[model samples]
Target: MNSSLFAVIMMLAVLIPSGMQAQAPATYYNSAYGKSGKALKTELHEIIKSGYVTKSYDFLYTIYEESDTRPDGKLWDMYSTCTWTHGQKKCGNYSTVCDCYNREHSIPQSWFNERSPMVSDAHHIYPTDGRVNGQRGNDPFGECANGTTLTNGLGRSGSSTFPGYSGRVFEPVDEYKGDFARTYFYFVTRYEDLMSTFSTSSTSFSGNAYPSLNSWSIALFLKWHRQDPVSEKEIVRNNAVYKHQKNRNAFIDHPILAEHIWGTLQGSAWDVTGVETPAELLARVNYNANERSMMVAADLGELSYEVVNISGVRLLSGTLLGGDAVSMGSLKPGVYFFRANADTLKAVKKFIVQ
Candidate 1:
């Protein structure tokens, strides 16, 4: 073959493969066009259902070592900060915190009677310490308060501390709260049809597609979702799961979809072909600690702003002529939302006060 022709062929080979790799996610998301609310949820369920590769329950031990590994190449055990080994770390008998890492169903299997698909779904199953898993057994996720029973530093299980809940509950550390929230989002969306059959042991889920989460659980999970955002671990695990299951968790790819579905930013119009541009801009708002202010670049001529705590308590509110700043006041350090409202546009952005 001629040298020029051979070079052109080689370039085509590299560019073709690279282009496909880059467009894979967009291609997968294309099926969700013109979808929102329950329609969107159901569409995603169908889109993801096709590529599922079911594995036996025992296979999760090997899978977790790869899918949940941390930055240091160690097993990512959420129940405790232990350096768990791959094959040897299977739980046999554990009486302590870091004894072994085992498969934990973030959504208790008993809720679905240990059925297929949901039982082994990697989205809700995690690699957690066995002892802590036992502590969290069958208890729904919630904040624990009085009558605390277990505290492994990475997790707590006890009587409910959250409002509107009065049952034994399990709460993972703050670092993994968003992880669990996104997983729960995936579970509900992927299995929207089956939700009605699963037992609502906790008030967290409502067993329906639209407004799939209860009021209190929506508040709690939304808070965690905004606070934690998506991390490198989540992205990597998302891709790994896609490789194994042939399906992707849409929320991990598009976090703003959570808000569009059931949280604060619900009812905002979004582009079904891709991620919402307005939500992306809102998420990128800058927080200036030195100025004690938050700002987003938008041309909303005359707008009002409000700073609210995670519990929906209004801390500060005022009007802003375009480009004017809103003071952070003497509010204590914690996660807060900065909401901007105009004639027809409204946006909510989350920022942390250190």
Candidate 2:
């Protein structure tokens, strides 16, 4: 933990309220309200693409310094456990895992003919280990069986064991499955207009704007998105990328948007208006000091919860089951908070985490 990064985190801890929700600036989704299904996706695509600021491929390196910085100040590389210093070590040659870092396009560049705009879109371009990025080699994400593990034991490459697809795939660390899943959602929606014209394509594309994702991808991504809810790491990174890109990942801001467009709530009109956020649901919940545990309010239905310190860094995250006590275990004395998706009930709590 370098002094500067530690200081920045501590300062953020104090400045960001424990219960504050990470969402858009009030009306960013205004145009999509009350729309559902394909109409909602089209409106959101218009909103994001219009707000986007164009930059170059090389400029992505500059953006990585901020977007991928870990809490410990090292570059946050998902593929390998390399403690990288931003702007210092870049991919030139690599014989092993920790050789250097490079940009990983979650969606392969070849699928879109390595063209501009999509080629440099920061939303899916990640800072990752060079060697593992090579290993992943544009393989679509999926669960694996009898796989060759990547640099870290956290990821793997092999035949897909995920229900729908049986092709070769690359599975990232469990911690980042949802991150990548939502990133896919953003890519499909933000670029819905350009689908047909792409130079090449993957099996994941449905060849139309309505349900841009293939059936297999639709099921796989929905599962990943639900199991791995958004984290403080994602929220911070989302804000950082928006600083340079001028557009935000709507899935990160409002995860439920995915449901309206493709999942369980597909036909329901998307209405963010007049919605009471999780902060407003605090009255229905309470902390159990003796149990050292938590859960979403019974009325909110099941959800995923994030526990964090006064500073917004995440401490723990898991399924927010039926109001049954979920053990939080030990913690240093300080004000901590518990929160869930703003799209789902928005149940949050401010309590001394211990």
Candidate 3:
């Protein structure tokens, strides 16, 4: 589906929700702000001091696996087309975790010098297949794919185009055009400032420098964004990745959230309410009266958060006192929202009962 239509679908899903907002949960805030390199290091130290699990490489691996979730043994998995089972042939037919697929950077890293940052930046890294990556080549994504006459060596055609420069361009499969579109949005947001230092065979951004990306690439991505909207799976993965990375992508975060944060941070606009955030940041419930609430406590332990009642209301919110027994039997319970916050980090959870 096109970006617009995909957005509409997401909107409808959000509107028809069982009480969750159409927007992202409060956890996105935790994923973005309130951390510096030194602060992160300090926080990691504190976690270690508290005997929390803190592995440097494990963090990256956790995010990678959560983002990819490939049961088929594909290094990175993509959404299934036919069924909902992970790696199932023609999957994505079910609403389960199977719909999300592993996408790739259309501009392969190997084309560049395989520099330290670009190669390692997980923001641009994708879960596309090795076969497709080889087919994409170093071509800039562009309009040549519109024509039928062109042919790529891999039986694909029309991927090459006038990149507004001497080099070539490539096109993505129709299904993933939107994925690349958002990925490009993410790429620009993550590295637009350093782009001038980036080595390119052609000067794609020499002129018409408003949003500042290769015109061919930008145009194609914009078209894809407008045509094939983001999927629920993509949005979920984007947030999950953000949770792991502690940075927000312009394309991945809800467009509004990105706009508000970017405008305020970039000084492009004066957003007064930027300081105001969801109540989840303050406190939440960590235990329940009825069941053991194993998963509920697990979220709190991992995220260091608290819980609240439904309706965005707060209940018991604080740091984990680490007592095995947490009292909750006194409160009336239909549904509840448990949350936790550490500076800019926040996590929300839902629970239900009799």
Best by lDDT: 2
How would you encode candidate 2's per-residue C-alpha lDDT over 4-116 as one tens digit per residue?
75567655443333323344577788999999899999999999888688789999888877677765457888787778899987988988888888899998888777877
**lDDT for each candidate structure:** 0.69, 0.75, 0.43
- Model 3 C-alpha lDDT versus the unseen true structure: 0.43
Quote each prediction's TM-score.
0.70, 0.78, 0.46
Per-model root-mean-square deviation over C-alphas: 10.9, 5.9, 14.8
Clashing pairs in 1: none
What does candidate 3's lDDT look like per residue over 1-354, in tens digits? Answer: 465754554443333222212344454334334433323223322321232122342244445555554222233443123222333332223233333333344446644466544555455565543343444456566555453321221224343554444344555555456666666556544544455555555423422212446546555565666444443345445555555454544454433232322222333332223323322222233334346352322222323444456444556644553233344554573655554443333334344433
Better TM-score candidate (1, 2):
2
The order by descending lDDT is: 2, 1, 3
Please write out the lDDT profile of model 1 over residues 144-256, one tens digit for every residue: 85544444537788888888787888887776788898888888888887878777666467866656777778887888887665644566577666766777777777777
- Candidate 1 runs further than 4 Å off: 1-24, 146-152, 272-354
Q: For every model in order, what is the number of clashing pairs? A: 0, 2, 35
- Model 2 — TM-score against the truth? 0.78
lDDT, residue 305, model 2 = 67
